[model samples]
Structure formats: C-alpha cells, structure tokens
Target: MSEPGSDHDAPQAGREPIFMLPPVVTALAGIMLAIHLATTLVLDNVGLYQLTLWFGFIPMRLLAPDQLPGGFWPLLWTPFSHAFLHANWEHVIFNTLWLAIFATPVARRYGALPTLVIFLVTSAAGALAFAATTLPNVQVLIGASGGVAGLTGAAMRFIFQPVMVGTDPDTGQRVLLGRHLASLREVFTNPRSRNFSLIWIVLNAAVPLVPALIGQDIQIAWQAHLGGFVIGLLLPPLFERSWQHE
Candidate 1:
C-alpha cells in the first residue's frame, strides 16, 4: 500500500503497525500519562506524597500499617493502582513509548477487555515480586513498568516468528500473514526470542547493581519487571486458547 500500483493486499490489515498503536494501547497510555500530569500539576508536595501513600504499593504498609497510612481498602487497591502512577514525565513517557510498541500487538490480538485483564494481572504479579524482595523496608513501587514488561513478554510468543511473504499464483498479488503463537519449548529453542528474553532479564538484573557500581541509587522496580515478565510470558497461550474456544 505504501507503493504505487503495488499488488500487495493487506491480509491481516488489523494487525498492529510499527508506528501506529492500537486504540486500547493509546487509551491506556493516555490514562497513565494523565494520572501523572494530574498528580504533578494539581497536587502540592504534601498532597502528592499523601496520594502516593494511598495509591502506591509500599510493602512495608502490610507489615506495619500504622507506620504508613490507610486501612485494608488501600492495601487492596494499591497493588494494581500503582501501575497507573509514575515517578515523573520521563518515567511515564518511557512506558508510553513501550506501550505503543508492545501493548499494541497484544490489544490487536486480545481486544480491550483481555488486554486490560493482562495488564492488571501482570501489575499485581509485579507487586507480589516487589513485596517478595522488599519486605519491612518502606519502598514505594509505582509506574507501568511491570505491566509493560508483561506485555513485552507476551509479545515474544509470536512477534519473532518469521512472516510469510508470497505471491498468489492465481491473483498475482503478494500476501502477508500473522505468525502462530509458539509454545514454551519453541520459545526457548528460537534463537531470536531466546536472545531477546535474555537481554531483557540481564538488563533488569543489572539495574540494582548500578548503585553498587556507581554509588548512586536509582529507584527502579526490577523485581516487579521480572515477576510481570514471567507471568506475561506464560499467559498468552491461555488467551489464545480462550479465543479459540470463544
């Protein structure tokens, strides 16, 4: 379609394009950025901190409720709610770009509701990972990194498969088709996807060690990233099966 008089017809025209994010992905990204903007512009330092106190997932809040704020309700929601909050414009913007890239494909395949479920599930899984690593210590974990990482892992199930490009003998037209979702064994055996996952894990593992190397601590929730990725990697097959049954 980009070329004049090209015989190529879009096979899965609905498939996510490189530059254009699906509507659901765009909307979720908008919500994340909007929340960050609202917190930054509308709330004072005290208010912002208070709101984060209520919304952000602090593992310590579970151990010593009086040391922090809120009651059972806050504990119940913060695990998932923290995914909607971000540390700064840079943080949200980074996640927004990744959402545009990775979540678009997931939204295209799974639709809005399933995509939302995946995000929420992965976000909660991330919180669990964060809590596992930092108990008793009051560390605030906020941002869509976990959910985004989950989406990224989910994308790995098929995105690396080779796209079939061929000319139809009858119509003399070129066609492209989407790839099949690979099983776990296939995922580890495929070099491109295996390498991609390795790089992702290695990068996240390196985050905590940065402070040790440079003596400047960064507030990255690497644990959440890994936890979300684990769930997301294994979760897509269920979605594919669900779609088949539906």
Candidate 2:
C-alpha cells in the first residue's frame, strides 16, 4: 500500500534475484574489503599507522599546514584517498554493507565509470565538509561512509517509482526496468522520500550522542555524511540528465 501522498504504491514491481548487484557495486565492495583486510591482517602496526597518517583526512594538516610533514600537498589527494581507508573492521563492514545496498542501483543506472566518478566526487566533497566542521582538530577521518551516504542520497531521487523497462509481449504489460531517475521536485515532494531523508538525517545526527553517553572516545563524522548526501542529492543529474530519457 502507498502512503496518501507517495508517488507510487511501492518501488518498481519485480522480484530481484539473490545478489542481483551490478558489476561496479561488486567490484568496489571487493576493493574496499581487500584493502581493509590488508591493512589490518597483513601490515604491521607501524606500517598501518604510517599509511593512515598519510592517507587519512586530517583537518589539522590542512588547516594548520606548516606543522604537518607533507604540508599542503597532501590535501589534494587525501580527500579522495581517505575513502579507501577505515579506522576499524566495524567501520569497513558498515561501509561495505551500505555500499552494497545503495550503490547497486546507482551503478546499474550509470554503469561502472560514472558510478566510480560519483563515489569519488562525493567522498571528496565529504572530506571538505568534515574539514569545515573540525577546523583545527587533529583527527583522522577515514571511511567509505561518505561515498556510501552519497549513493544513498542519490538513490532517493529515483528508487520509489515504477520503471518502464519494455513491453511484455506475451502478457501485454509493461516490464520493470532498471533504476529510474526522478526530478528534484519529485524526490522532495514524495512522502516516502521525505520520510526516508528525515529518518536518515536523524539517525546520523544522533550517532555522536551514543558514544558520548557511553564515555567512549569516538567521533561519528556526521559532517562528512551530510556533505556527501547533499552533493549526491544534487550531483548525479549533471552526469545522467542528458541521457536519462534515452
């Protein structure tokens, strides 16, 4: 059943086969996992620390450039590099799972090349967002959450409506197509999308409080999540709109 103001009764009608993931989704997930495994299981502590220091997005390094070893040069690449690093197993697992769920549809819609671009671009945007909030703090921000969040936000623009794949000649009915991209107004106006966005924002914003309540020294990086999501919500159209109807 559809909500009173929802655009559709439910997502496109179809039963998806198990692991019906696009190649780009599968490949990216595998790469994240492999890198995490190597960093945790293969590399020694010193090596891991060095790698993290070099690759992780550190706000202090960029804000107070003279004190850091690489100076300002690292800023250009760290935004993109940090997406491939994770602070722990839980972090990588969390990101990979979300990536599988959200990125699958996007990869299917845009194919491998464009999907990769979206992930990297949103992640870079996320790094900047994180930096803006942290200012002078010497903290390492590492995870795929930014890019995965971006994919989730991007999906919100289209995943709710029925897709027209083609005619079922024998049954004389329209088939469920791949992912359908919706307009900006459609995404904001749809009840389902609105509720989804609200829930996501609330849950993410509340994450920092959880660790605080328990006295665990953990930062949730909600700033990066918001940054990626906003960009994801707005950016995909630039890559897709031209060929969307084709």
Candidate 3:
C-alpha cells in the first residue's frame, strides 16, 4: 500500500520534535543555581566547608578503604551530591552556564530519562578520573562542570553521527540506518562544524591552563573535563550502535 520511498520519510516524520530548554533541564539548572547562591550567602564558611565534605567527591579520600563508611546510601548519593556543591560563586556560575547550554540540547535530543542517566554516568566518570589521578588529601572538588562536559561530548556524537533515512535508488525503497558517520571528506571540507568543535576543545582545554599561568594555586580539575569529554565523544557510538541492533 505504501510507496517504496515512504519508509525513509516515515522516520523523519515520526521523530519527536525537540523543544528548546526542556522543563526538566531548566528546573535542574535553576535548582542548582539557587542552591549555590544560598550556600554562598546564607551558610557560613564553616557550614559550606562541611557541606562540601559530605557532598563533594574527594577521590581517594572517599574511595579509600579506611574512609569508606559502613553504609550504602552515602555511596549511592555522593555522585548526585557532588554535582550540587561548588567551590565558590565563580565556580558555580561558570559551570551552571555551560550546564544549561550543553545540557538543554542533550536533554532535548535524548529525552529526560536518558539525559539524566547520561549526566549521572558521565559525572561519575569525571569524578572517578579525578580520584584516580589526584592525591587524596589535596583539595575538595565540586561543581557540575564535569557532568556538563559529558553532555557536550554526547552532543558531539548525536550531531556528527545522525540517524538518517535513505532510499535505495534502484528499488526506490526506504531504509533506516540509525547510525551514520560524516564523511572523512567532510572533515576538511566543512569549516563550520569543524571549527566549532575545535574551538570547544581549545576553550575547555584552556580553562585549567589560564589559572596556572596567573600563578594561582587553583586546581582546575582538568582531569574531570578530559574524562567527561572523552566519555561524551565515545559513548554515543556504542550506545547508538547497541540501540540500532536492538
């Protein structure tokens, strides 16, 4: 009953359109921003430090044998809690802006459930990477930047390897290849996407370096950023490929 090429068009038509700044992500961003502001203003310095100790991911300190509490709830909750805490106003504002920007796009593409999963997983990965590399007693690390970085990484995958419907020209039949890669030819030929991607890498990579050059003792947690970005870039292919087969 249907035309040969109709199947190809069906997927495009059936796609749930993405709305800008999905409610869940917006709410999350607002809540996180509010918490950071409240913590900075209402809470005393000692209270803030205690909050960070409980919520922040301190790598080896939390994961070490002696430090592990005799409880499961702390382990399960730390990942989410770490995201809510921040070192300072500047730290929270920077991370919150990027989280809103990158996360909105990812939430729109993957829907609320998957987007939340990605955020938690990638944030964990970022923290894990930090913990593995840094000394246990150095300093407390807090913020959503790691998770936000993961969303950016994930977005790269969705944007680059799009799901498409193509027609078999000979038979005029439509086929869906839920996973597609941009051509190598396009990498050199397409300046816009290439430049944009390059710029993102440069800016994020530079974030840590700037403070170092200024002779500041600020630890940038470059490890988390790199970890999140790698996870973002790599996970999409594996996730989508598995989905396609299923």
Give per-model TM-scores. 0.85, 0.82, 0.70
Order the candidates by lDDT, highest first — what do you get? 1, 2, 3
Per-residue lDDT of 215 in model 3: 79
What does the lDDT read for residue 233 in candidate 1? 92
Least accurate 10 contiguous residues by lDDT in model 3: 179-188
Quality of model 1 by C-alpha lDDT: 0.86
> Which whole-number lDDT from 0 to 100 does residue 239 have in model 2?
69
Candidate with top TM-score is: 1
Per-residue error at 57 for model 3, in Å?
Answer: 0.6
Compose the digit string of candidate 3's lDDT tens values, residues 1-246: 666659877887778857457877877787788998888789897887777767777665554635543333455566667887777778887887787777776665556776777777888888877777776565566788778888887776545555689897899999875435444345334575467667767776787678668877656777777777767765554445435554
Error of 1 at 181 (Å): 0.8
Candidate 1: regions farther than 4 A off: 1-19, 163-177, 242-246
Q: Which digits, one per residue and each the tens of the lDDT, describe model 2 over residues 57-101? A: 888986688887688888889998999998788888889999998
- Candidate 2 regions exceeding 4 Å error are 1-19, 165-180, 208-217
Which residue pairs come into collision in candidate 1?
none
Q: Which scores greater on lDDT, model 1 or model 3? A: 1
- The per-prediction CA RMSD against the true structure, in angstroms, equals 5.7, 9.5, 7.5
Cα shift from native, residue 185, model 3 (Å): 12
